[model samples]
Target: MRRRDLLASAALPLPAWASAAPERVLRVGTDIAEVGFDPPRVSDRTSVTINAHIFESPLTYDYLARPALLRPQTAAALPEASENFTRWVFTLQPGIFFADDPAFGGKPRELVAADYVYSIKRFFDPRIPTEHLFHFENAGILGLSELRQRALKAKTGLDYDAPVAGLRALDRYRFEIRLARPAPRFVQLFAVPGLTGALAREVVEHYDDELPAHPVGTGPFMLQRWRRGSQVRLVRNPRFREQHFDSLATDLNAEDQALLKRLQGRRLPLVDAVEVNVILEEQPRWLAFHGGEIDVLELPPTLAPAVMPGGRLAPYLAQRGVQARAQVDASVRHTFFNCEDPDIGGLQPERVALRRAIALAYDNTEELRSVFKGQGVPAQSMLVPAVYGFDATLRSAAGSGDMARARALLDTYGYRDVDRDGWREHPDGRSLTLRLAGLSDSRQRAINELWLKKMRLLGLRIVFEPGQFGELIKNSLAGTLQMWSYSWTTSQPDGDFFLALGYGPNAGQANDARLVLPAFDRAYEKQRALPDGPERLAAMRAANRLMLAYQPYLPHFHALRVDLSQPGVEGYRRHPFTRDWWRYTAKE
Candidate 1:
């Protein structure tokens, strides 16, 4: 709906903060444009970051928890699990209401347990391309998958009214979920507000296909304006419930202690508005922050050494009263080969040899030094630090750089310069060329140049296909991209999702590589089913070995996240799990 139409539809006064002073508006920059606000349809970090403020989930991570601890958001308390983690129940906080919307007929709308139930069911609806369906499918929610398959075979929309034995609202403010298998960490799914936020059925039915633009939820902020690919403005929700800043963390640094002392009982969303601009280039974004136009910045790696030398704020920035916080992120950057592609995919000996050769030739150290400014640690395995199932003792050759071994493997696989053109050819003398998809940015160009040099050293011809990140994500999901390099960050402390990249069932979702090895899938399932112990560790290690042997993905490095805030911005801290930190900060 147009702004005028939307305003005319509601008979309500503007929020008090709507006319507050301009300083109440906090401005920030994103490195890329968001895909959209539709949680189910989005898989990118930028979109999820923006949506998290406008949506509320059952649970959220504590702001100061180091390893990341989950706490209740809309829920009255932590969920109760029983029956060996097969059944879970959640009780919603009473009297909570969604942000005002025309779908509510201009009357206050109370949030209920049914809203959460309907929101999750939307993922199974065939009409929607839910990128996180693999998460729900992996949970083995009873009868839900069958309902989806039934709709698929019937060629019709899912019967949302159909009573699934496993998923149902027990009452107006409580719901129950029964799973087919044990899921000890299933509650972690509740912490992802962007994907699992509650949505009223009426609002969904009203907007229909336009739900992405018309998001209504019981969150602190509501979308005020959106200029696609340029900027977005979010204002405090007029009907947001009263909540105070609090944490259960016992161990906090002096900085957090001071922040808590000042803002402990203050009403949330200290800022009245959040304005996010899509600044794709690092130079422009860095300049914006340096000039005080941007309130917070992640501190681009290219400028990190000069701006915040030795992991501390430069003297000049500190003189300006700027504050900085840094931590090694729970993320892994990697280059993935589409296992379905004919040239570098499949289990055939020659195809596997080609992929292994490429993996061996990758230079992680040079890329880290040149592109990341030596601000990250070389990734030893798929799992990064601080996540469960990560074993520092386990060593793998996936991150190793060896040109000699790569050349010998190619030679043994019959890849040679048949025509003496300094580029290798297939066993039958067909020219070999590899295409790598990446964002069209200077950082990506630098990384791609590294790949170009590495491939040339191995007598292989390689080309970089540059495009917008959103379009590249679509190509990756479709399994059409030959290869691509990107980072995968953990949403929950458990790092199983990283291994899910190779799970046979996740091919069209998180598994961009399209790998479907039965052995790897077995190990992955085993680890998920077992409790956290030596048995589970062994299972995960076995799966990691399969990934290294197949060379489906060449792990790069784990980045160090360094964020800086302007002088008067208070209570700014980066959480490893959640992205909705705007609520905890204020600007002077």
Candidate 2:
């Protein structure tokens, strides 16, 4: 598990003199952008890279634990429910406005019900591509299933409008929802970033094509311009409410002191302007941040200086004491396999075979120490300890490959040395070897090479292959390649869904290594139907038992994200799938 205790212990209390004074401008550094302005269409971390000032969500996540809620953020008090758990209502805080309204000309918008309805319906919009649709399935939203089927089939048209029986536009401030069954997290689901953000139907309708590059929401900031594939800029939301910071601050917290010093009645956009610059390479960014040209850097493993060079960052780290402000999901990063191999289930054991071979071949320990620099724990299964369906008791003994075991498995499976030669042969006497393909990035290429060396030792002939990241991902999804490393960014804490959910097209789609275990599917179906809590948790455990019995992929480690920022940046946070979560964070 991540050393959460260390982060909590290192936390300092805010000084009593703290106050929310105004400030302006937050300059940011980011990588490349994906596409889409609408939240539902966005899946890549760098794609939604905007500031909190420009965007906001109705349901905010409570840091204590991740579950969505009806409030803008997770609340100390859970929402109250009616007698039958049938009708769900949420009351929003009084005054809020969108960031770029000409009415406020750049004010936040008041939260309301229709906004939620619009957000929910977008999933069913053939035009809108929301990877989070599974989250909306059980809300008892009218015509959801039919709409989803049509949307998935046609990929456009608002056939879902007529099915509004389960959802309502109860006045302006309050929203009501009916659930088919009780989901404790149905309300909290709204708090999550992608799930509950309310969108103005007018804006989405007007600039539908331009939404991705130009974000419009009731957050603290608004998008001014996006220099595609390069950088983005934002201006503060003039009508931002909740000027007070989150109450979790302590007097000694470094952020409190910094906020106090930076916000002293300054104009919004504290500086002349804020820029979220995109840099694909790491060296230039560190040089800029070090030279004081840049204010913050979301340094990844490939970006962080392994040996703090010359003690240059010592004072800055100590004096600033600003740390990564997000929950590190151990499950966020892992390889997806091509579970759909025909023979793997047809002529051969498709998923289970690949999983067994890859797991046994991978040196998770070495990757954890060398690549991650001991910043992360190795994951042996799809679900990490933090996520549901994860079996903590399952210790992987695969990396310790024994030729005896490898030979035994291959011999029984038909890849045996029937011919008296160095190379093994399949039952049909064909060469028994395959190539491992992965990203050509220096770090990944290096790791891939190491795995190749290890796999060769297991009496298997190995070839190291390189391809463009996108192409490799495409091939993995199509099941065209034998073995490749794949990544699913927004993996859930209780994720067995990628394998069980029937979306066969989401690139490097989860369940790529299609195992087709009925018991696993049944357990997952049970899991999917349950609200995201203990009952779902129990069903997921049973499913994990199925995963353990049938290994599906060579599970890898979640990347431990490391970033460097100058002092005075506050409210910068992270999410499960990203190290580059840009928007929703404020700067002094």
Best by TM-score: 1
Global lDDT of each candidate: 0.87, 0.55
Candidate 2's residue-wise lDDT over 122-142, tens digit each? 776756545566566644555
- lDDT, model 1, position 198: 88
Q: Write the per-residue lDDT of candidate 1 for residues 1-588, one digit (tens) a residue.
A: 474355333334447656766648888888978877878898777888888898898999998767688899999999999998999999999989999898999999999999999999989998888668988899899999999999999999889999997899999999999999988888999999866788889998998866777778888888877777778778888888998898877888888788888888889989988889989899999999999898988889999889878877899989999888888898999989999997788998899999989988887888898899987988877888888888888776654779999999999989999999899999889888999999888999899888888899999999989888778888888889999999998888886878998998999888999999999999999899888889998999899889888888989999988888998899887788887899898887
User: lDDT of candidate 2?
Assistant: 0.55
Estimate the TM-score of every prediction: 0.96, 0.77
| Candidate 1 positional error at 6, Å | 11
Q: Lowest lDDT 10-mer window, candidate 1? A: 3-12
Model 2 poorest ten-residue lDDT run: 10-19
Q: How close is candidate 1 to the true structure, as a TM-score?
A: 0.96
